[model samples]
Target: METKRLNKAISETGYCSRREADRLIEAGKVKVNGTVVGLGVQVSPDDKIELEGKLISKEVENIYIAFNKPVGIICTTDTSIKNNIIDYIGHPERIFPIGRLDKPSDGLIFLTNDGDIVNKVLRSGNNHEKEYIVSVDRKITKTFIREMSSGVPVLGTVTKKCEVERIADHTFKIILTQGLNRQIRRMCSYMGYEVTRLQRVRIMNINLDDLKVGEYRYFTPSETEEINRLVANSGKTMDASFD
Candidate 1:
């Protein structure tokens, strides 16, 4: 029987990237035919690769979805959490959210079973854009826009410079490549503004357009192609950002 590297085998199942596979393997979470294996182990196609007691194989088709999340649904894979995004969608495939939206803030978020692409789209270093339409408690000022666009120190680190534009008296558009924790909300607060409402209008090339809150759809052919092209050179590494 032909054999392959363990990490590549895991990635081919669309469960996760080779890096994640290596991590799991080293963590003693991945097993081959009932034996816990280390990194660089090779296994045959028929070898049963189990991760955390769940069988992973070629039959698991990758799923991609653009979900228009409604406020109150938390982004988490743990079913014990009440009103989690997984239970909210109730999809047949065991997919998870790419990033997160605050429990009180919502809009476009991607869900997928294609674990290999998760880091490619979320790493701050990749420079993938996430666009938000925000409404603040007070009128947006020029200084607010300038400071926001420049950078705001938060979470003990300054956020990356981003694109900000005033679209209304109390509302504006902002695009960010980094997904700092509660980054937008904190940035606005630093500018002496409170976000009354925040909705993510876009992530990368996908948009929430016409999708009412809580609705979801699959990506089009062009969207899939363009996204693959965009992330072709992306560094597939995880970061501590919601990005």
Candidate 2:
């Protein structure tokens, strides 16, 4: 069997994200085959793994969850205090959000144990589109729409030319491939408009139609397979860049 990165193996077991796995491993909390392991180690399926003095017997299972995140809940796994999405969902298997929508923004957020899929979905070069409906404090003019669609400077960088069309007097829909931190809000601010409300409506081909806020649904088997194919194709495309 092929050996996988220790972080990948640890994440597959649903303990935490790969980054978190590194922290645990570096802290001398993880052991493989009765030996305390270090960073950048690889493990195979036959290896026994333990964390924090306990042997982890839980077999990793791939799980995908689509959640309608309501405003206010942070999309983080640091559940040391109050409400976090992880504790809110309460899934038996540990899953992390694919990408984040800000606390003030709410909509379709994907939670899954499929680490490889997350990389594909979030990679900018993959060109997976995220659609959002944003409401501004004032009416949106045609000039403003044109300029916004052209590309606006948020902080030091100019955003890519994205699809921005008016949906209502003060409301518009936008599609973006980049998942910059609080991107939409910052973009609108740069255009001299205060975003009164923002909600992500879609992620790639997935939509949040009829899913109530705070509710979640598992991806169907066919959906899962299709997504896997898309991700695999993306991987091949990325690999060719180095050749």
Report RMSD (Å) for each prediction in the order shown: 2.3, 4.1
lDDT of each: 0.88, 0.80
- TM-scores for all candidates: the values are 0.90, 0.88
lDDT score for candidate 2 against the true structure:
0.80
lDDT of 1 by residue, 1-243 (tens): 889889878876767656668889999999999999898999997899999899988776667899999999999888899999999999987677888898999899998877678878988899999999999999888899999999989989999999999999999999999998899999998888999999999999998999999999999889988888999999877684653
Best by TM-score: 1
Model 1 residue 26 lDDT score: 91
Model 2 Cα displacement at 51 (Å)? 3.2
